[model samples]
Target: MPLQVAPTFRDALAAARRPLVGMWVCSGSPLVAEICAGSGLDWLLIDAEHSPNGPESLLAQLQAVHGYPVTPMVRPPVGDPVVIKQYLDLGAQNLLIPMVDTAERAAAMVRAVAYPPHGVRGVGSALARASRWNRVPDYLRTARTTLSLYLQIESAEAVENVEAIVSTPGVDGVFVGPADLAASMGVLGEQDHPEVVAAVEHCLRAAKAAGVKAGLNAFAPALARRYLTAGADFVLVGADVQLLARGSERLAAEFIEEVR
Candidate 1:
């Protein structure tokens, strides 16, 4: 019998018919990854960019969450072709590539995730888990069709070129990074600043207008809801580190105040 590949978070995002909520996992721990995977999230971002997760750590985390229903989306430190190749080979079907500034870059990323005659992703031998160690037959041939590529629109320049970037063929979606976008617009941490909000909203609208999926990393519930209402296909509501820090701080603060 042949392998049966299930629908991915990317497939849902590409459909763009509803809102898919997700979270960021920066802890790089399989324990933490498994815990979050049980939280009923639609997807999870295994952040190798800001997190300490190298390829090995990412592989472990992906394995930890393999039994869950949630899809694991990995973000490389940078959107380099070689880096993406390794992640794809490790069984990551959904990707959030960072710092994409042009349609050319987005197109390149699309090719990076595809096999020959479609893109330049290097073919690996039977050593990759992506093929289930030879379990997933013809993985090289079918990978291009199942792989979902979401480019990160994190800069003023990227936001300016949002429409063009969304128009790139094989680019499944675009994720707006408000933090970097704010910094780019001269508002270091003011993601809620009217200017930054406008830019993010513009990108969201642009993607939707182009009939492509739009998503964002909005940590605040109200903010995330606002974007979803404005037609975002998916939104990453929070990060593991933020939840741990805030929850721990709240727990400790209550005790400290009671002792005082």
Candidate 2:
């Protein structure tokens, strides 16, 4: 099977007038990644920040998504240079860095994700497992251009600095992490909090002004729609575990009611 490059996701988002649906797969299971990839999702995000997945697990998940229609993305714990470089080297086409609060942080993330001159990402095996062990010789040439870097705007500070953050070079897009943003504003679990909503709107406006894409993490279709209508370029839906739990609970409840 021909290995799909990172451009697929970038192009998909670029071409979409409306928001694209992305499912979060944090289980670190290759099987689950494959399933999600074939499930008509526009993209799959492997959560390394909140999930228990280490480097190896992340790599496996990325590999599993290969050849499928969904583009694979990794959400690293933070925007640390080493962590960013590690996942990029492992072949993650897109990276979602969490808790980006300032333009400086966004710029640092860009530097971490890019190579020399542009940034300080240590290069090793260009033909390593990330490139299918020499299968793609031109990997380095296209790597910088093909890579997608989404900075998570999830705090009051981030919202305030939204304009500067989006304007930073190499920052492909901005994703709103509503839960965290709400919490940071002292309103935990209130996704609909006035402050959170305002912040999201600010991010959208900033992204649009900067001519860059914007994204959001939403669990429900309704929530996703809200973001889309607000001009989000990409929308991430529920996680694999959450989907499974919800489905299982509903099925069990239905069966119990039928028996009664």
Candidate 3:
């Protein structure tokens, strides 16, 4: 039989034309991934960059979330081709590459995710879950069609080159990382600082003009809405760790205060 090309989350995201809300998964727990996947969010990011997720862990998380409706986007530590290849082979169709600073780097990420004659992704689908152990027919030939590549603009330099980065062919979207952008602007933890906000807005506008999707990772709901209002195609409102911490804290405070 020919490959059954099911419509992926990337397809849904591109067609929605509305901000797709998501959350970060840094817990490296398949259970957490499964829970988040079933939460009805548009997408979920399996973070290998800041978390202790290795290939095995990523595979488990991917499996954990496969049955849900949520799209799982994986982020490697950097935009290294090797790391990207590993994640892709492990069945990550959507990627959120980090620390992209220039058009050249962004272009490299595009190439890294594709196969030969288009890019340099190594072919090993037969041995990988990405092809369902060779069950998803013609995976190598059609994988690029379903792949979504969103580069992170986390620095002042990246903000300056936003136009070029978003205009690079095959880039699905641009993700503005306010936390790192704030640090790069010398404001450290002040993501809402005027300068940082300005930079983020600038990138969003640039992406809009370039006809590419824009995204943001903002913890605050109000700030996330601001980005969506400013034309962000997607936004991450929270993380698994933050949710756990805050919920546990609230629970403890509620009971501990009763004893006092």
User: Candidate 2: where is the Cα deviation over 4 Å?
Assistant: 1-8, 257-260
- CA error at residue 59 for candidate 1, angstroms: 0.6
Model 2, C-alpha of 256: deviation from truth (Å): 3.6
The stretch of ten residues in a row with the least summed lDDT in candidate 2 is 1-10
Residue-pair clashes per candidate, as listed? 0, 0, 0
Kindly list the per-residue Cα lDDT of model 2 for residues 1-260, writing each as its tens digit.
33535564677788876678888898878998888889998888899888889999988888888877778888998788988888887888788999999998888888897778888888764445666664665766666876888889999988888999999988889889999999999999999877788888888988999999998988767777887888888888788989889999999999999999
TM-score per prediction, in order, is: 0.96, 0.93, 0.96
lDDT of 3 at 247: 100
Collision pairs in model 2? none
C-alpha lDDT (0 to 100) for residue 158 of candidate 3: 97
Q: lDDT winner between 1 and 2, please give it.
A: 1
Span of 10 residues, lowest total lDDT, candidate 3: 1-10
lDDT of 3 by residue, 1-260 (tens): 34453455568776785679999999999999999999999999899889989999999998999878888888999888998888888888888999999999988989999999989999998987778777887788988986789999999999999999999999998899999999999999999998999999999999989988888999987888888888888899999999999999999999999999
Provide the lDDT at 38 for model 1. Answer: 94
